[model samples]
Target: MANAIWHQWVGCEYRVLKTAKENIVSQRSASPVLSSYARLQRFILTALLCWTVFTPGAVQASEELHYALTVNVNFGQDLGQPLGSLFEVRDSQGEVVLGAGFASVYNTMLQGNRHELQLYLHGDRDEALEISSLPRPSPAMGTFITAYNGELLANAMNYGSPMVWDSASTTWREDTTAPRYYQTPVASGNLVFRPSQVEYQGRTIFASERTTALFFYGAGNLFAWEEGESDLSKAKVHAVPWTPDRDRADMDHAATLELATSSAFPYCYGVLDNEVLMVSNLGWLYGFDGEQWRLIQDNSGNVFQMYTMLNVYDRLLLGNFPTGGIYAWDGNTLEFVSAPLDYAHSGMFEAQTFALYGGDLYVGMWPWGELWRYSVLDNEWNLAARLFSHPERDSDLLTPYRSLLRTEFPSREYSSHSLGQRVYSLLPLSGSLYASTSARSGRDGRDIFHFLSQQELDQYGAVHRITAPTEASAQIRWTGEPTTFVLEVHSDSLRILQDGVE
Candidate 1:
C-alpha cells in the first residue's frame, strides 16, 4: 500500500517505464493504486520546484531614510563624567554621514568637573549597532562642545587634546599638527559664538570670546593663529568698567568709568560690515575703527535703546528688546520702522532675530519664536511663520525645515539654562535642524527631544520615540527626506526604518 501511494504520487514519471525488468520490479514492490499515488507526488514536487525557480519573492527594497540625532547631557553625582559622548550615524565605510553636539556647553564644562560626552560611530551592517561612551578626562571640568564648519564632526574640548576626525580609521584624533599658536586653552565661562565681524587695520576680523572680553581675531587667514597667539598673550582685556581710565588710549575707558560710577552699563554691540558697532545699553551707537572709536549716533538722548542691530543692504535694522519695535539706519539718519503690539512690552528679555536668506531679512522674536520676512522694496514686515512647541498649531515654522547642521531645525529658540529641559541652541546642517535641550527629564530621564518632520509626524505622531532614556539621554534622528517613515522605539534600541524594515 505504501508503494502504491508513492507510485501514485510520482504520476507520469512512473508510466514511462524504460525496461520490462523495472516494470516487473515495480509491480512486485507496489500496488497499482500506490504506484499511481507515488507518480502524482513526484509530479507535484517537480512542478513546485520549477515554479519556485522562475518566481521571485514579493518584498521590495526599502527606501533610504535619514535620522536626526539628539543628545541629552545627564550629569551624575560623580564628577567623573565622560567627555565627547558623541551620537553619530555613519555609513557602511565608517565615514561619518551625520553628527552633532552642544559644542558651547561641552567646552564650558570641561574645566571644572570630570563630566564628558563622547560618541563614536561603529558598524558596517544594518544589524543592531552599539553606541558606547568614551573615557572622561582626569579632573575634567566638563565637556565643552564644538562642531566643524559644517557641524559634521561634533567635538569636545579637553586641555591639550587635538581636534582631528580620522575618516580612514573611523576615529577622532587630536589635531597634533595644528600650530601651537592656534591652540588656546578653552575659555573658563559660559560662551556662545556669534556671527559678527569687525574690521581693523584694513583687514576684516572676527571676534570670539575668551573669558569676558571679545578677542578680535582677523578673518580670511587660515594661519591667523600666528597673529592671534601673539596678540592674545598681550591682549588688553576690557570690562564694561565704571572707573575712569588714567590711560587715554582706552576708547571705552571713560564710558567704563561712567558705567562703574552709575548703576547702569547700557551697551549693545553688533557686527556691521566688519565693524563692531557698539550701542550703549543706554542707546548710543559708536563705530570702532580698529584704532580709535568714535560715536556715530546717540539714541539714548532719543526714544529707543538699541538691543540688537543688523546691517542689511547698507541699512541698519535695529531691534528694541522687551518691546518688538524696529528701527532703520539709513546712512545719515535713523528712522522708526514699527512698534510692538499693544500688549507686548518693549522691554521684555527677548532674543533678537536677524537671519539673511535669499536677500530677504528674517527676524525672529524672543519668548515666542515668531518669524517675519522684511521686504526691502515695500518696507514691510510680513508674517511668515511662528515656531511653536505644539504639533496642532497652524504655523508652518516646523514644516519642511532645512538646516546646515543636519541635527535639528534651526528655527527653534532655546530657553535659558536655569529652565531645565529646555532647548538652548539651534543648528542647521545639510538641510536639517538640530537643537540641544537644557537638561534631561526627571521621569523617563530624556533630556532632549526631536520633532520629526511635519509630514512624518502627521503620518505617525508628533513625538517619534527614539531610544532616549525617559530620564537621562535624549535621542533624535533626522529623516533627510520630506516623506513619511517609521520611528521604532524600544527599551534597548531605537531605529528609523522605512517601509517597516531596518
Candidate 2:
C-alpha cells in the first residue's frame, strides 16, 4: 500500500504501476533513495534562497566598521593663551579628525609658574578620551627642546635629558639615556648648538667643543659612557683602524679627507654634490675634496648674520638673523635675494620666529606677532597670516622679543605650537594642521591645537559631531516555482491560471 501511495505521488500523470516498479528497483540499488533525494533538493533550495538574500552588497553593509580619535594639546608651561589644536587619526578612515570644544587649562593672570592641563576628545555621546597631557616644569629647568624623527617625537629637557612621545600609544616616556646622545653638547649656557657640518662614511662626523680633531660616531651605535666620567666621549675619530678586507682599507684610504684647521670652530658646514662647504663666523667659505679643506672665499660680504644655511638647487642659501633676509651663495659670490618686512631681525625680541614652507620662507615678528611669507620663485612677499598682533603703539612693553620658530620647510599647510605659549612649530600631519604652544613655567601648561581640513569641517552641521550609520531591517526575499511547468503551459493556460479558472 505504501509503495502504491509513493508511486501515485511521484507519477501523478504517468503510469503508476511502471513508476512503482522503478522506485522499488532504485530502493534496492541505493539505501533510502527517496529520503536522500528530498533532502538534497531541500538543501539546494535553501542555498539558492540564501544566495539571493545575502549578495555582495548585503555582506559589505554588515561588515563595515569605523574607529574615532581626538587629539588634545595641553600647555604644561606658562603661556598667555592657547596656541592651536589639531585632530590626528590612525584608522581605516584615512582622514583627519577635529575636536568639539576649546578647553582652557591655565589662567595667565594668576602668574602661577606651574600649571598642568589635559586635552580631551569627546567621542560618541560625550565619551571623553584623554589624548595627552601638558606638564609645567620647574623654573630652573628652563625651556624644553623637541625633535621629530618622522614617526617618533622626542623632546630634551635642560639640554641633554631626552623624552619620547609615541603617537601610536599616545603616551610619553623618559628617554634620558637615548643612544643618539653623543658627547656632543647641542647647547651651552645661553648659546644654542647647531651642526656646522656633518660627514657620513659608514659613520657620522660632527664638530663639537671638545676636540679639534674630527670625531666619528659609527652608524647604529648607542650612546655609551666613558670609563670614569659622568659624561660620554667620542667613540672613534679616524677611519676603522683595522679591517679584514684589503679592498675596504683601500676604499677608506681613498674616501678620507683632511680638514684645513685642526680646530673645528666653523659655524656652518654642508655637503654639495661631491664637495663639502664650510662657513665660519668671521665670514669665510671653505671647500673640501676627499683630501683637504681648501679655502673658497675669504668673506661672504653680505650684511647679515648667518643663522641657518642650506644647499638647495645647486645653490647655497643662507638665513640671516637680526635682519631677517635670505641670501644665495653661488660657488663664487653671495647675493641678497629678499628680506622680511621691516627688516625685522629674529634677535630683536622674544617670540619672533620664521620657517621655510613649500619652498617659501616665512618669518614671524613677535610682539608685533605678524607672519610674512616670502616667495622664492616670484621674488615677492605676502602676508600669509597674523599669528598674534599687538596694536602698533605700546608694542615694546608687551613684546618678549625672544620668540622661536624651529622647523624644516613644511610641505603641508598646517602648524603646531611647542612648549612656549606661542606657536612653537607649524606643520601638517595626515592632512591636518597641528599647533603646539608651551607655557614658560609649569609641567602642565603645554597645549597642542588642531585644525581640520575644509572638506571635513563642512560635513558637520555644527562642526562638533560626525556622521554615523544607522541599523536597518533585512531586505525582502523572493521564491520561484519550477520553470518546466511554465514552458508546458501556453499563453492561454497562463491567462487561465491568472483568472483563477485553472
Candidate 3:
C-alpha cells in the first residue's frame, strides 16, 4: 500500500453503451487523432465485451484489486483533486522528525564508529544536521560544522586552516593537542567537500570541486594542494606534514610529489572494484594502487568527464556530465546502457543523481526530471516516476497530488513553487524515496517526497471506460489523437507470437 496515499479517480463505469458508441462514431469522423484514439478504444471494448461470462465473485474481486486503467486523455478539466502533504521531514516510524529545507544528504559512519546522517541546509549561513542516531533520525543536532572525519581531520571550507574537531572542548582548534597530533597543509578557498571519499586507517582522502587538489590527511601528516597550481599543463597532487610551530613560508616544498599531470583537476574520485579511481573533468581516468598510477584506458570515451560513480551489484557505474548516458565498466572496458543522445532536442542526456531501493536502481534524469529505474534482470531502464507532468512530455496522467501543485502554483514567483523541472538530488530513506528539484530557469525549487505503490510498480494495462452523458441524446467530445486502450488480462484467450499468428 505504499502508493495508496497517492491516487485519483482512475476509471469509471457506465451503462449507456449505445449512446457512447454513437458519440465515438461522430468524434472519429471529425479528427484523425480522434480516429486513432477511437480505434484503440474499440480494440479494448472488443476484448471487454467478449468476456461477458464471469465467476460469482469476479466483479467484486476487481473492486478490491483496484482494477483501474490508464487512459491516454490529452485534455481533461480538473475534478475535485485529492490532496497530500508538503515537504516535511519524516523518520523511520513515519513520524514528523524535523521541518527544514535540506539540499543534500550523506550517510556515513562518523570516524568508522558513531553512525551519522549529514544534511546540508539550503540557506547560505553554512549549516548542517548531525544525526548520531541511525535508522531512526530524530532529535538531530544542528551545529556549525564543516567537512569531518570522525573526531579527527580539520575544519574544511571557510572555517580556516585544516583544524581538528575537538569532541572534548567542543571547539575547532589547532591539531597539536592530545590524542593525535596531525598536521595538513592549509586548504585553498572555496573548498566544497564531496560526499564520497576513501578512508583507510588514519588517512582520509577526499577531492574538491573547483581546486585541482586531492586532500590527504593521516598519521600526523597533511598533504594538500597549494593555493595556486605549480604547473598549468598537468594536475598537481601534493602532501605536507602537520607542524604546529612552523610557518607556511618556513615549510619545505620539496616533499610535494605529483600524482598525475595529464588532467588539470581531479573533480571526482571513488572506489571501483576496491581500487581508488580518479577522474578529471577534462576526460581522463586513473587508478592508484598505493604505489603507481595506472591509466584505465576508456577507448569508448564514455567514462571521460564523469561526475558521479556508484559501485553496485559488482558493477562500476559512471554518470556523465551533460552529453553522455549511464555507462558501466566491465573491468576491461565500458559499455553504454541508455541515453537520450538526440542532444538538439533531448538536451544533455546525463544522470544528475542516483538512488538504489527495493532492488531497483533509480536515476534522477537531467533537464527533464525523469526518474528512471534499472532492472537487474531485465537490464533496461523503465520510466518509474516523474517530478513534473507536461502533456507534451509524458502520456501518463498527472497524479492528483501533482495536479494540485500545477493548478495552485503555475508560475515561478508563487509561494508554493513547482518542484522545478529537474531533480538535483535523490535519497531513499525508510522505504520511501525523497527527491529535491532544480529550476532550469533560475527560479526557486521545491522538495517533495512520496512512495510508489504495488499497482504503480506492476502496471499491466491502460484502461478507459468513458460513459456518455445521461439518456436524452449524447455527443462525445474528443480530440485529434487516437485513444488507444490496451487491456492486459490474465487469460490464454489470445496470443500474438513472433510469427504474427494469434
Candidate 4:
C-alpha cells in the first residue's frame, strides 16, 4: 500500500487539505500510518477536469490532454466499478463538472446502493482533496451502508458477508468472529434471510438480519443480540430469537408458549421517551432497557408493519408498509404524518426510504418506485418523481411484484424474482439527491430478465441523479429574504455543497 493521508491505496499518492471540514480527509491521530506493498493492478489514469476548455471533437488515441490529477483507486480490487470522474469540480459558472457513478444494472437487492461521497483530488499536495475508495467485503458483493464510527464498516446485503476494515492488520476481513453474523431463522433456509436492515438510534447503529440485531456504538463497541422475550406466552428466552416466523405463513403465531420467547424479523431500533423501542415485522413492539425485554404492544395479524423509520424534526417517523403512510409512534398507537404516499398504484404502497435534502423530508415508496418530497412551505406532500418506469407496471394495475401480503390476501400474488421493485435507498450527495431501486431478490450482478427492454430494465438498480427542469422559477420558494425550493430535485440541487450538507 502506498502512503496516503486518510486511506492507504496502491499505485497512487493521495493527499488532502484538512480545511475541508466535515468532508476533510485526515487520519485520527498525528502519527504516520505504516504501509506495505499490495497486489494491486496498475493503470494509466488522468482526471481531465479542464474539459470545459477542450474542443468538441475527439483527439488521437495516443493523445494526452491537460489534466488535474492522475489517480487510480480500486482499494479492495474493485476494478470494474472504478472511481469515475472527479467530484465537486466546478466550471467557471460554479456548476458540477463530472457526472458519473458506479450503479448496478440488474440485482439491486444486493448491489443497488453505492454512494458517491467525495471524488476530489487536485494535483497539488497541500491544496488537493483526494477521494479514497472504501474496502470491499472479503467475499465481495456491493456497497450498501458504509458507516464510520472511528472505524469503517462496509456492509453487503443478505447473500454477501459484511467486511470491516482492520486498521491493525491494514486489510479488509470478513466479519465472522468479532461478533458472528445473525443466524438464519428457526426451521428456515437461506431464502428467508432478507437484506440487512440498518438503522441508527442515538449514537448506536443497529444492523439486523432475521431476528438478531448487531449494534455498533460510536465509541467503538459492537454486540449482537439475537434473543428477546415473548409477549404472547410471557415466556423467557436468554440467548433467543424466539420470534419465529417465515415470510410466507404464520410460523410464530402457531408456536407453543414455552418456545414462543423467540422473535421475528426486526425493522428499526426506535428510541422514544429515552427507551430503546423496536418493532418487529410481525407487529410486535418491544422495549429493551439495557437489561431485560418488555412487551409494549402486540398489534399482530398484519396490523402495523413498518419497513423503515426516520427522525423528522424531533418526530420519529416510521414508514408503514400495509397502511401506505408515514407514521410516528406515540408510545401507544401509530399516527399518520403523511397518509398513503402513492395511492395511484396498486400492490403494497410502502414508504420504504427517506432523505433530508435542504432541510425538507423526501420519502421513497415501493413497488412503483415512487419518490415524494414533503413541501414544508406549502404544508403538503408532493410527488417528486417516479424513480422507476417499467413498461410492465401500470398505474391502475399492480401484481407481478412480490409482496409480504401475498399469503394473507388471496388477490395479492407473488411474481418472479425480476418483477419486484423497492426504492431501496435515498442519498444526498454533491448537493443532489439520488434514489436507488432494488428487486425482491436478484442474481450476482446479472440481469437475466429478458422480458424488459434495455430502456425499461435500466430503471432497476439504477441511481437516478435528480436534476432540474427548464422552469427554475416555479421550483423555487421564497422564504421572506432567503430562497428555498418547492421541488427539491431541481438544477440548483446539482450544485456543489457550500454549507457542506450532502
Every candidate's lDDT: 0.28, 0.27, 0.32, 0.36
Q: Per-residue alpha-carbon lDDT of model 3 for 285-322, expressed as tens digits? A: 76654344577853244434665554443345666655
The regions of model 3 sitting more than 4 angstroms off are 1-263, 298-304, 322-324, 340-347, 389-421, 440-502
Error of 4 at 191 (Å): 27
Which residue ranges in model 4 land beyond 4 Å of their true spot? Answer: 1-263, 340-347, 400-418, 443-448, 467-502
Candidate 2 TM-score, true structure as reference: 0.37
Order the candidates by lDDT, highest first — what do you get? 4, 3, 1, 2
Candidate 3, residue 270: the lDDT equals 44
How far off is residue 484 in model 2, in Å? 58
Cα-lDDT of candidate 1: 0.28
Better of 1 and 2 by TM-score: 2
Error of 2 at 449 (Å): 26
Worst 10 residues of 2 by lDDT: 1-10
- Give RMSD to native, each candidate: 25.8, 27.5, 23.9, 18.2
Model 4 / residue 223 / CA error / Å: 6.1
Off by over 4 Å in 1: 1-147, 152-211, 216-268, 271-275, 280-284, 296-307, 330-332, 339-351, 375-385, 390-502
Q: What's the CA error at residue 491 for candidate 1, in Å?
A: 44
> For model 3, what is the C-alpha lDDT against the true structure?
0.32
